[model samples]
Target: MGHTLSSLYPVHRRAPVYRPKAFVVDDLATLHADIRSGGLATLVSVTGSGLVATHLPLLLRESDGPFGTLLGHISLANTQWKETDSGIEALAIFTGPETYVTPNWYAAKQETGRVVPTWNYAAIHAWGRPVFFQDADRLRDLVTQLTDKFEAGFPAPWRVADAPENYIESQLKAIVGFEMRITRIEGKRKFNQNRSAEDRQGVIRGLRELGAQGDTRKTEVADLMENIESEPPAGY
Candidate 1:
């Protein structure tokens, strides 16, 4: 399934004030891939008292539709699910590589003393209507899928069936399953896209040097920026 920029949430952040349109990623595939790669997301909701947030590993069912559904479970002991009102809009935020960018890294700072520190990062926001379920069968399937996904990279993957049937059932009862039908998605990649080529190169070099010294995140961000600078939009 494919999505258009029209399906994205309206921009109401400081991004429009400083980050140029070039940094706004309208590509749905990129957003989906980012969500998949960055499995953990922050699910936030508003309750009567105030707001709540939970961090969980979410599964994106791409086959579901253009804006795929998000699947995850919450501990029954954690009452967020109970507090969550069905049909209410919720936001799921998935983040990618992020690092502190020093103003000294920009060539413009040297040429015109007109640079400030900023953060370089990538992120996606997914808005959806949440639905909670307690069906044992559905919960079983969801747990199985989550287990399979997380364990796939292991040399010896563990299966849910490996556990005793009664034990698994008891464990399943401790959690509740949820599915959020995604309605709108927005992605932002702040990789100095608004800066000149020389400034970008300087930033990339500084990041790589910082990464080589010890900062792993800077290394990853540098690589992402390099790739974005080299590849065409369609290629990404």
Candidate 2:
């Protein structure tokens, strides 16, 4: 896949000041790998008159060339694909665990009651052109890869081919395979990078005490924070 500014830049819109994020990812391969390992993402598309969104597992196929293709499928009964206008773009959003930060989580808040609640999270948005296909062979390949990835933990791993031939064929007919040539990718690691070191530590401790998905993500955020602290300042 070829890397170009036109393909990797985010579509900017002026609105919520809170929506602006630091665009940190500069490597396509690293960004693609993150999305691939994250496994699931929300695919959003706009039709002529409406919007359709579906949560699904996606596979990223790497190419030696400039761009990679995203592989996934949607139910045949879902008319969203057909409703979308030709050349319409789509967004696949992958969100990691996120947590709301209460003012109480900040040590600075104890001294000054000016703090407001915020959220800490990690997410990536991938934009691409959708390519839908109904070919039986392609469908089979997609199903096989999806099943294998999800079933690898089982004692007797499930295999699509293990099912009766007719059953498998019938099942494959019920879905449409699609490949998206990713044209843009934007990654945001909103883990309180804007906060002071002490305040970030306080947030991490608060999240850990909460012991939820957000807390689990805090562990990762903590690691990132450590790495940032250890690195030499840029242009030093």
In terms of TM-score, which candidate is strongest? 1
Task: Write down the TM-score of every candidate.
Answer: 0.87, 0.80
lDDT of each: 0.83, 0.72
| CA-RMSD of model 2 | 6.4
Q: Could you tell me which 10 consecutive residues in candidate 2 have the lowest summed lDDT?
A: 10-19
Clashing pairs in 1: none
Scored by lDDT, the top model is 1
**Deviation from native of the Cα of residue 185 in model 1, angstroms:** 0.6
Off by over 4 Å in 1: 1-19, 233-236
Tens digit of per-residue lDDT, candidate 2, span 41-126:
88887665566898899888878226577889999998876775445568888876566788888878877777888877667787
- List ranges where model 2 is wrong by over 4 Å: 1-23, 212-236
